[model samples]
Target chain A: MNNQIEIQLSAKRKEKPSFSDLKFGKTYTDHMFIMDYSREKGWYDPRIVPYQPITLDPAATIFHYGQTIFEGLKAYKNENEEVFLFRPEENFKRLNRSSVRLCIPEVDEDLALEALVKLVSIDRDWVPDVKGTSLYIRPFTISTEPNLDVTPSQKYRFMIIMSPVGAFYKEGMNPVKIAVESEYVRAVRGGTGNAKTAGNYAAAMLVQEKASAAGYSQVLWLDGKENKYIEEVGSMNVFFKINGEVVTPELSGSILEGITRKSVIELLKHWGVPVSERRISMEEVYEAHQNGQLEEAFGTGTAAVISPIGELFWNGEIISINDNKTGELSLKIYNTLTGIQIGKEDDPFGWRVKVE
Target chain B: MNNQIEIQLSAKRKEKPSFSDLKFGKTYTDHMFIMDYSREKGWYDPRIVPYQPITLDPAATIFHYGQTIFEGLKAYKNENEEVFLFRPEENFKRLNRSSVRLCIPEVDEDLALEALVKLVSIDRDWVPDVKGTSLYIRPFTISTEPNLDVTPSQKYRFMIIMSPVGAFYKEGMNPVKIAVESEYVRAVRGGTGNAKTAGNYAAAMLVQEKASAAGYSQVLWLDGKENKYIEEVGSMNVFFKINGEVVTPELSGSILEGITRKSVIELLKHWGVPVSERRISMEEVYEAHQNGQLEEAFGTGTAAVISPIGELFWNGEIISINDNKTGELSLKIYNTLTGIQIGKEDDPFGWRVKVE
Candidate 1:
C-alpha cells in the first residue's frame, strides 16, 4: 500500500476567521484529510482535499442508523512558529476502538497518523499563535452505505477536519457550575459508553440541555443502572479532590477513558499527590462537601485541559467548591499540561509530536 | 405557513425492479418528500422531487453527534388496486415524541401527514400487488447544521423515502431462533429507547451481529440494569404465551412501544383472550418452559408483522417452543393484522388510512 497522501488545493480559499473571535468547532481550515473503506477493498485512495460538503444518498446508514464515531484533539503553535500535536496517535488508536464498538471498519493507524501530520503541515498557517488559541482537529468516521438497515455498512468514510478554536475558558480558566442529573442517564455498563461514538453524545443532549436551561454549565451524569454512582460531567471524564486524595470513577466499561484524564493522573502521581480510580458516589461527594473535605473538583477532556468545578447542585442542594475559585492543584496541573502541550515546558514524557 | 406542496417530477424514469426479486430498502421509487426546519422559519417548504442524493457539510451534527430520528411504516395494495397505510398518523405522532427527546424541532404533524399522503399517491404504482410485497415507507429527520458541537442543531431536514420490499418471511410465516444477549445492552429506562431514534438501533448492532454469527436469527435483549427482565427481541417487541396467558413486557421507557404490539393487544382484548402487559423476567420464562407452560413466543414489528420464536438459547440452555413450529395464536394474529392492513378484512378498528 502506498503511504503517500495526494493533495488537492482549493481553487478558492476561504477567508480565515479572526483568531480572537473564534468559537469552538465553528471555523474550518483550508483542507481536510479523507479516506474511504470498503468491505472488498479495505481502506484505499487516501487524499487531502479542499474542505467541502459531502453528498450521500438519502438512505445512507449514517443519517439513519447513527453508525458514526469521532475523535477530538488539537494542533498547537509555539512562539517559534512551530506546530505540535499532543499525542495524536492516541486519538487514532481510540478511533479504532470506537469503530469496533460501533461495528464500523477500522483504519490503518500508522497511515491515519501520517495523514493527520501531513494535513496539518499543509495547513500550518491555520494553527493560531495566540495564547489559548489552537487548531482543533476533529477526526471522524461515518457509514456511507445507502441502505436503511440496522447493521454495519459495507462502506465507510474517515475524514479529518480542522477548526481554529479559541480557549474553552475565555475568562482566565474560571470554574463552572454543574447540576447532578437524576432523571436521565448518559450510558450504562455493557453499552457503548466507553467508545467515542455519536450515539453516546446524542443520548446525552436532552439532559445537558436541561442543565443549561437551569443555569448550570453542564450536567454530572450518574450510573445508568442505579443512578447513584458518578459517571461523568457533560462530555468529559470527571475528577474530584477530597481529604487530600484525588479520585475519579474507575472505567467500568461505561465511562470514556479520556486522554486528558490519563495524563492528569500521571502528572499527579509524578508530583506525589495521592490519586486513585474507584467507584465514587454522589452521596459521598455531598458528604465530603458537608465535612469540608471536598477541596476541589474538575473535568478533563481534549477540548479543555481542565474545567474546574466551582459549584455542584444535587437534588436541589448546592455546594460551592474552594469558595468558587480555582483550587491550587487544579491550576498547577492545568499550567503544567498546557506548557507541555505547546513547546513552552520540558518534554520529559515525549507526548508532543511535531508537524514537520 | 403555506400548505402548498411543490412538485418536481423525475424527467427520466428508471426501470423498476422485478416484484419477485425485490429486497428490503434496496429499490426506491422515482420521487420523495422533503421539508426543511429552521429556528427562524420553523418547518416550511414541503415538496416532492425526484429521488436523489443529499449534500451536507462534513461537520453536520447528524454525522458527528447523531442528532437524527426516523419512523417506519408500509403502504399496501389491495386486490382492487387501492393503496392503504397502517396507523401512519401514529408513526408521525411518535416522530414528534422522538424529536422532543433528541432536541430536534418538531414538524407540523398534520402538514407532514398531508405531504406523505400526496407523495405516496404520486408514487402509488410502486406499491406492489404481490401477496407479501408492499412499498416500505421511511420518514427520517436529520440535523444538517455544519458544526461539531454536542448540542442540538438549529437546522434540520425531514425526508420521506419509499422502497418496494418483498416479504420479510419469503417461504411463509416460519419461526426463527433467537439468542439471549448476556453481555451487551440495547437501552436504559432514562435513555432514548422509547423514542425511535438512530442511536438505539446503532448500539444494538454488535449484539445482533454476534447472535447472527451464532446461528440465531435475532437477539433477545434483557434489561440494562439487572440484565434479568426481558426487554425486547432484536428490533421488535416480544410476547409470550405461558399456560394460556398471553403476556408481554410493559412499556418500561426502555423498550419501544411498537404499533403492531398495540394492535395485537387490542385484537386480543376484542376477542376476549387473556392478555396482559407487565414486567416479565427471563427466569420466569425459563421456569415456565420447565413446567411445560411456555406454549408460544413471538415478536411484533411493522416489517415482519409477527415473527414466531421456534427456539430460544439462554445461557447454554436451549428450549424449543411449540415443537419448533408457529403457534396457532401467532398465525391467527398475523393473519388478522395483515388482513386489516391490506384491506382484506373490514376495518372495524379504523386502523387503515387510504392514500387518496
Candidate 2:
C-alpha cells in the first residue's frame, strides 16, 4: 500500500445513530478523506482526517462562484458483513467529465478510487444491516481560492464523506406522481447539464419545491429549446414502455448519464426486452396513451435505483400509467440491481467491487 | 443609532496597498459586516467585526448546492474626502430580489442600507484617494446548513466585505472586441438568470474563458430559446446605437436588470436621446451594419460604467462599431456617470446617497 495517504484516526468516536432510524443524508461517518489541489502543487496531501468544520476565507470562491462538482454512490453490506461497491469506477469517470466542464483540474481516477476504498473500509461498521439501507458516499470538489475574480479558482479542495441512508422505500415501493414541468427549464445542450455540478442542482430546486407543493413527487423536465421533447424526470433518467418496446431518452448533452439508467438499459437488453434510445416527446406519449398503448414509465438514479412513475400531470390532464401502480418491470429491475449490489445474486456483469 | 449592529474594531491594522497599484477585488479592508439566519431565530446577530476567515461544516450546502447570491457597488470620495455610494438602496433591493429567487430569506432593506453606511463610515479611510480608485463593496449570502437533502438550507450567513479597487481602465477606456457566443447558454426563461446569483456567473465562466482565449474581451450571449436575440454582453447589460436610435434588450425574465444599465437609460432619456428597450437580434444588428446604420455599441455594469464594444466576431464575420474606437455618446455617458459617482456632477435624480 504505497498510496501515500496519511491517516489520522479520531481521538474519540461519535455515537452512531440507530441504523433502522436513519434519514437520507443527514448523518455522517466519523472520518472523511481530504485532498488539496493548487496551481503550485497539482494535488497533494491526501489524508483521512476526523470530520470537522473546515476553515476558509470569507471570500472563498465556493461561497460566491459555484465552481463545484460532486458524485454519489453507495457501499452495501451482505449478510456476512462483506462491504461492496457498485460500479464505483463510473462515478470517478463522471467526476472527471464534470471537472473538465467546470474548468477545475481533473482528478486522478486511480488515486480517487484508492482513497474511496480506504475511507469506506475504515468506516465499514457504519454500514447499516437493514434490507434496503446502504452507506451513501459523497465525493465532492469545491473552489477554495479567496478571490472575487470570475475566472476559475486556482485552489480547490476534494473530500469524500459517508452517510448512512435508510431504505428509500421505507414502507414499500410506491410509484410516484410526476408533474410535467413547463415553466422552468432545467438544462440545455452545450450547458453544464451533463456535468454533475452544483449549478444544475441549484437551478432545479425552486421548481422542485413548486412541484412538491403541488402534490407531485417530482418533475418531468422538457427540452429547453422547444419545450416539446422529454429530457429527464426530476434528477433521474426516465424510460417508457410503448407498444412492448422499451425506450429512454437519448444522451443529448443536456440530461445526466445516470449509471443506474445505463445498467437498466443493459439488463433489459440482456433479457431480450426490446429496448431503444431515442428522442422522446410528451406529445407522442400522450398519443400512445390515447391509442391505449402506453405501458409503463419509470426513473433511474443512484439513490432509489428505480422510481416508477405511476401518473404524469401534463397540460391540465392526468395520464395514468399501468393503473397508477408499480410496474412489474420496475420492481424486477430494482430487485435485480439491489441483489447484485448486496451480494444476494450472482454477479454476471461484474458490477460489484468487493472490499477485502 | 439604534441599528442594533454591534461594532468591534480591529486591535491592529495591516499595511494598506498603494491606491495607485490596487487590483480589482483581491485586497480587503480591516472590517466586515456579518449577519446570521436560522429557521427558528430568523435573521439575527448583525455585527461589524474584524475581517477574518469563516468556519463551516464540510457538508455546508454552499459548497455543494450553489445556494448563494451577491451584489456589487462602490463607495467613492471626492477631493473633500466625503464618501458617497451611488444608488446604494438599489443594491439592497436587488439583493432581496436575488434572495427570493434563490429561496433564501429576504433581508430587511432598510437595515441592510444602514449597515452598509455604518460599515463604510468606519472604513472610510480605506476609500482610495486616487482619481480612478474607489472602495468596492460586495454584499453576499451563502447557505451554511450542513446537510445534503437537495432542499433549501435552514441556516444562512449574509456578509458585506469592502475592497479598494483600481480603475477598470488604468489607461483610457479603450473599446473591447466581443465574440458572439452561440455554443453555450448563459440562462433561459423561468431560470435564475434575472437573479444576481453565483450559479449564473459560474455557468458563464467557461464561455468567457474561451472568448478571452480567442483574443476577445467578452462574450455576447444570445437567448437560450432561439439562440438569436441578444441577451447580454459578458456580465453587463448591452446597448446598441443604430441609425441614431439607442436600443437594448428588455428585461424579459432572462436577463439581469443592471443598476448601471437602468441609470444609463435614464441619463439617455434625460438627454432626450431616442432610446427603446425591445428585442434586438444578432441578425438585425448585422443587417443594420450591412446597411451602414450601425453607429455604436457598449456594455454597462457597476465595474465599468461604460465598456464600448468596438468589434464583434460572429459567424466568420467581423462587425466594427465606430471604426473600432469608443463612440462619442459612449464617452459622454461614461464621463457623466463617473462624474456623478465621484461627486463632481449635480445629482438630478438623487441617486447618490452620502455615507455620513
lDDT of 2 at A80: 93
The segments of candidate 2 whose C-alpha lies over 4 angstroms from its true place after superposition are: A1-3, B1-3
Clashing pairs in 2: none
Instruction: Name the docking class for model 2.
Output: medium
- TM-score of chain B taken alone, every candidate: 0.99, 0.99
Residue A341 Cα positional deviation in candidate 2, in Å, after optimal superposition:
0.8
lDDT per residue for candidate 1 within B1-356, as digits (tens), equals 77789999999887999988888888789999999988898888899999999999999889988999999999999889999999999999999999999998888889889989998999998999888899999999999998887889999999999999988878987899999998899999899989898888889999899989989999999999999999999999999999999999999999998999999999999999999999999999999999999999999999999999999999999988999999999999999999999999888999999987
Residue-wise C-alpha lDDT for candidate 1, range A1-356, written one tens digit per residue: 56578899988878998888888888899999999888988887899999999999999899888899999999999889989999888899999998999999888999999999999998998998888899999999999998876778999999999999987777798899999999899999999999998889989999898889989999999999999999999999999999999999999999998999999999999889999999999999999999999999999998889999999999989989999999999999999999999989888889999998
Backbone clashes in each candidate structure, one number apiece?
0, 0
Residue A172 of model 2 has an lDDT of: 91
Name the weakest run of 10 consecutive residues (lDDT summed) in model 2 chain A.
Answer: A1-10
Error of 2 at B143 (Å): 0.5
